[model samples]
Target: MTVFDLPARLDATNAPAIEQQLLRLIQTDKPALLVCNFAATDYISSAGLRILLLAAKTLRQQGAELQLRQMQPAVADVFRLAGLHGVLNIQN
Candidate 1:
């Protein structure tokens, strides 16, 4: 299991950096479970959501999984609004 502590703001500005990090993880021989801790994240833009979805897709292709945990209310709402709860594993 590998975990990433997401920042407080996940917008277009920082989404790419996060994406690179996740991509590196995917390229490595890591565990199947990748956890993103969003305890500090209160906002996430569409770009951020896209990154998450991309990460999830890549992990799935690698026979792995992605788990998002401790999401703030606002961030969680964004995910819900995007109807991504069905595609991603989110834990309140």
Candidate 2:
């Protein structure tokens, strides 16, 4: 499985980088493990969250696995606040 290791910060400044990495992995003709790191990210806006949703949706369509892990309490709260905790599987 492929693992997409994300940085602590994933704001607009590095969204493109994350986008590129995600797109590259999803297009691959094999299963993958996307372990996103958000431990240092204290904030995430709607647009930023959209990136995760998009990635997960795309991966699902492509029959790949995307697992998010080590999410900061603040960041996980963002998912709960946005009502996406159930939509995406954020490792505990």
Candidate 3:
């Protein structure tokens, strides 16, 4: 398992960069399980959700898994409202 800590804010301003980092990690490490820690993240814009969805897809293609953990209630709500809660592996 590989664990990654997310930034406090996930918006268009940093979504692209975060995407690159996640892609790089998945490509380089090829971990069977990738866990993103959202303990510090309180905000998530649509852009952030997009990257996460992309990451989850990419990981699935590699027969790996992406897990989101400790998300704030608000952030989790964003995912839920976007209908991503069922698509991604999120753990409260």
Provide C-alpha RMSD values for all models, in order: 0.9, 1.9, 0.5
Reference-based lDDT, residue 47, model 3: 95
User: Relative to the unseen true structure, what is the C-alpha lDDT of residue 27 in candidate 2, on a scale of 0 to 100?
Assistant: 76
lDDT of 1 by residue, 1-92 (tens): 99889998999999999899888977885669999999999899999999999999998888999999999888889998999999899987
> For model 2, what is the C-alpha lDDT against the true structure?
0.76
State residue 9's C-alpha deviation in candidate 1, in Å: 0.6
Give one digit per residue, the lDDT tens place, for model 3 in 16-77.
99999999999999999999999999999999999998999999999999999999999999
Q: What would you estimate as the lDDT of candidate 1?
A: 0.90
- TM-score, every prediction: 0.95, 0.82, 0.98
lDDT agreement with native, every candidate? 0.90, 0.76, 0.95
1 against 2, candidate with superior TM-score: 1
Off by over 4 Å in 3: none
After the best TM-score superposition of candidate 2, give how far the Cα of residue 65 lies from its true spot, in angstroms.
2.2
Positional deviation of 45 in candidate 1, in angstroms?
0.2
Worst 10 residues of 1 by lDDT: 22-31
Residue 14 CA error for candidate 1 (Å)? Answer: 0.9
